[model samples]
Target: MNNPTNSKNPADVVVIGAGIVGLAHAALAVGRGLTVTVIERDDRAVGASIRNFGHCCITAQSGELYDLAQSSRGHWLYFAERAGFWASEAGALVVARNDVELQVLRELAGRREAGQVTVLRAEETTAQLRTAQGTPDPAILGGAMLRDDLRVDPRTTVGKLAAWLQEQGVDFLWRTSAVGFDDGAVHTNRGTVYGRRTIVCVGHDVDYLFPSVSKEHIVERCTLQMSRAAQPAGLTLGPAVLTATSMLRYDAFTEMPSAIELSRTVDSGLQAIGANVMFTQHPDGSLILGDSHTYQHTAAPFLSENTTDLINAEIGALLGMPLEITERWQGIYASSPNGPLLVKEVQPGVTAVSVTSGVGMTVSFGLAERTLNSLFESVHSHRGSS
Candidate 1:
């Protein structure tokens, strides 16, 4: 549809979706002196970006993803300062309670170039856990301290970032849906808007615009469950926390030689259901805890108490006490069998990007930088050849 109210002059870039991925592209484009207009179906960002644990588990990533996460951390801190949001560079503590789990930590520490991970002695690890008002399990052999991770309040970070972008001159078209796109214009339900380039960062809604590309890439949905626990009096978590079960989830640790045995010793049900427990404290003195992964074409809009019980039991074993759950929720994100992220050109001037894993918050900014660089480089190359 055409509307006279829509901007007649094409913007430098038009972004679809206002989640972290879309916001990241808008922030980068505007920072580079490009005008940006972002369109979102919802009035506000209420997606995986805000529904996550807000943990930038940089140290737990591997290979290219790890490097992207490290770069994304810099952007997170930069925005956090100006956005007036709460963010912590306190890092993370991955606790190990058995010999096999301890072995995994030791192996990971040996590969320090991968991350700033250090293995801590059992007593030291337990002492650290005690600081957070919980006694560590007596069986805890040791733990690894990842010194490069970050934590933020996901519930607030997205809103703050969006607001900051708005103040920076980025136009946000909230409650507008991009139905389709061509070489130079996006067709939305509201109107047609032209842009030199268009980027789609719709987290998991593949069917909205590029259903064909989404299917060809084997994109699917991953559902997870999370909960918040009331903080204990006088307790402060020094850093985000992870238990042995988390070892089976994070790639940095799972690739270690010791992980095989550690996985074997873990509960089969936990592995079968893809359950992992991680803890991060919030400004309101509540702990954000989660989560289990279930993959499918579409996730059921229902919470499974059995999954919650499994998560609580596993995390309780690590803390030596059960937490009082205050809130429970679920999150779904785009996933792929190929990898954590997928970037493909849906058309000449339209690009589709999805954080096909749950690490969107950790790596979105970095991915945006890389994507924009490639986009502009291609444009320059084509112009020169022509």
Candidate 2:
């Protein structure tokens, strides 16, 4: 087992919160040959990192996020291979059940390079669903194939990555809660862990440690409902499936010219739930379906049956089959009205990074790369003058 206590020797970088964001930072630091230590309150990750679809929603981002997601794609594959995690490059399939939805897909496809986003015919889209009865939903108009997206098993990827990082000589202080931070030390419940730099990545709990910074960024906890169901009959879905509701959520799709019309055309029931009717299949033949968005300063612990039903029903109708839910949970992530990211140097040698956009999985590695690159450059420049 990896060490559960802080190392006496100071590390080059110390990361708080062992979710994807923290793990990504530790991984990048290790790659840079920096000594690192990761602090986690839990023995294992049980946060938004594990309770997610694991879909790196790459192709559906716009502008800065799109560039970051594209960079994240390579790093995801790189770590997956070396860390021995399961990652699939099957991409994503956006299902359009109506003409307006199809138009949005067409517009997006046209804007992208060839093969990056391929608008598919109804029959082609149906084939990608892999339904048991070999039938397509009557509402299926057409869809688009997003070629750059990737998937990892959210339940296991972080655990595997954490183990791999430990193997790479990154120290881990599990069940260690970080209570405070200074220029070169993290004051944990157990004791202080020294490091040259400290990165706080506590996700939605940012307010707990840095209330002012969290409040400054207008950060809120975005709670989403998700469920897992046994695979229907012979269903063998590869690509992550997205629906018209998803089009309304992702910036790339929302930016399309037909997006407004598509929005107007969506069912009121779906809009009521703030649904992003999407699903990704696990290797175990189970389907991970989600989700509905609701933001608040403090997330409600309750999961609404009505919300889950709305999302699951939509997914079932798209698959041409009913679902038998085996598990259900609420996913909480950092969100903000101000921006998608909160990368602020809260104090000297201490930075707090949070993906306030709920795209942590999509932008994890890339954001870490940008953060570390800037830090490294600044460090080198400071040393050069000193």
Candidate 3:
């Protein structure tokens, strides 16, 4: 690979992936007084970090993650403002379609601290979005939407973050692929690049990096299809969205479906995995719509016509507007056990991580500190045995 950004001077640390997780690690590592260089195969930001809906999901996360996401949102807001990135904290609606689902949602709200989650009725739900699919089943519900999920333009945010990282004195090695590792040298397309410490946040590429660890840490590249449409002038809503499944999927929503409905949702082919619908809008007068999930082994094809149409059908039915189809794309995210989107190790002075998982945008800020602490903290200790 032609190394567009290379240096004769070796770095104190070489980050293997330039995705959000890797960028987060690099930024924090540099801040910790370590000379960091980020290497990537892509010259621009177009992977999961720039592909997904760019949701900073607060309600859909678990205990420590929720707090982490909340803090991440704060940093994103600050950086986004300075960089002129399109960002909004327009809260999300985790709708329930049936009585059973509503029962589940009610349970969720009751368990959380008041205002942590607010349960909305069909009328209130419709009142908020001003858009409805079918009438809520008395037994199933219209669904409950959270008042906190924030949406940012992925392309805008990541592109700017990468630029800012450069300004902050962090080095980048774009269009450079890592071949492998042995001893202390990191094998790359541009040949071995030696460093004092290293980190890898390769998303789906993890399978190739460590085949044995792949089984223990399975990364299913969830292909999500998304669409964009031009919105009529003066038409707008503030928050990103969650399907009805989110109410059940997220820990924040304690009230999930009843035993009966939950069983039905889990069993039915379409509803089984809780694939409902989600909604969000962009400031450029275009709406970011999407997405369906499918797992693939490697190099998963993102642009799919069939699934894109399927997702759009759901959107049209629910939105009831003549949406002008504008952009179409697919995203690959990493999913694994225990739901940590980030993992870091400093052994041999190397840190390999991935957050191609859904919460990359929301969780990156919070995970940055942990990623470094796991690696640099031990090495940077000044208190040596006297």
Candidate 4:
């Protein structure tokens, strides 16, 4: 909904890509009184940023990413209020259906500082789920209630944020492609746009402008298949839900002692295919569910019915009921075996950054703030020397 004609003026920062990363950079720059122009190839953001579960899985993150997620949590709330979007502080309910999974939760709880995580007995978890109109499988041994996560409706969050940014005076150039960049300008299909600094947050399309860096980092595309179901009548899923399979996938839980045993208990096929089940509810009472990860240099744009069926079966076991699926889709994000994120100076006064770990919505705000601060400091230092 932003007017492209209004974006002809030069800006302090020109951000390429209108996904969450670019939008985060523009928001932070504008907040610091810098004029910003954002360019997107699509008329609107239609990428991993919008296709995700809108989960800021704070409790499951580890190391630097964990800190980033914690810092980003406040921004999620702040933007939700300013952008007029739905944001929930509802954490995560990680259900453990067996003793091995319960042991993993117990080990994780023991390692963390007090009060950060709470382990609930099977009866307690069932009672809480029942209160929320969820029917937990009787086989569920217990659950870990991670109190720090957040969720938003992915389908609408970015659109709302982009609109809010326009209201804050940020310019957007829709359907524009950046072919290249120089010292302080971007060469696009429209024309050359000048800026004091340039930041590229193009998500998985790394080869578009920086093929060398993308190749050097071994960046590949990771595809995931997801589905949504009409919420059962009168049911409110109080928190984002995860099954025991999630324990083997999230580093925070996987690094724990009992995780090995839990992993051994899981099906080898699911493990080999990197399938994990997660559920987050939207305000409209629809449950967004997913997903299986498949990585390659170029991901095939096909959604496997087998993967969908596996996801449904896994979640059905936890929910104790069959869900009426309403929609199905697939999303692709950048992935790297080298690191969780890629941040490098692709050229003078231009930085290229990508969230290769599918945590863009989780850590983008904090990461952007840090990136902008460092960039501004470098520019100031150069000016002082000159």
| Model 2 lDDT tens row, 1-386 | 23333455788999998999999989988888898899999999999999999999999999999988988888899898889999999999999888899999999999999899999999899887866654658789889999999999999999999999999999888988999988888888887888989999999999999999898999999999999999888888889999998999999999988899976899889898888899999989899999999989999899999999898888888877789999999999999999999999999999999999869999999899889988886432101000
Residue 151 accuracy (lDDT) in model 3: 85
Distance from true position, residue 144, model 4, in Å? 0.7
lDDT (Cα, tens digit) per residue for candidate 4, span 1-386? 32233334668999999998998888778877888899898999999998999888889999999888887787778778878989888888888888898888888888888877789999877665552344768888898889888898999988999999999998888899888888878888877778888999999997667889999988999999999988866667879888777887788998997788977788676676688788888888888998899999888988888889888877766766778899999889999998889899999989998998878999988788779878885432101000
**What TM-score does prediction 1 earn?**
0.94
Query: What local distance difference test score does each model get?
Result: 0.84, 0.90, 0.66, 0.84
lDDT of 3 by residue, 227-290 (tens): 7877734555676756554544455543343533564554244353224356577767577886
**TM-score quality measure for candidate 4:** 0.93
Between prediction 1 and prediction 2, the one with superior lDDT is 2
Please report the candidate that would top lDDT against the real structure: 2
Better of 2 and 3 by TM-score: 2
Query: What lDDT is reached at residue 360 by model 1?
Result: 93
- Choose 1 or 3, whichever is better by lDDT: 1
Those runs of model 3 whose alpha carbons end farther than 4 Å from true positions after fitting are: 1-9, 131-143, 182-184, 232-234, 254-260, 263-269, 272-276, 299-306, 337-347, 378-386
lDDT of 2 at 107: 94
Candidate 4: clashing pairs of residues? none
Candidate 1 residue lDDT tens string, 232-351: 555578688888778887899889998989767888878777888888888888888899999999888899999988887777777777788989999999999978887988889999
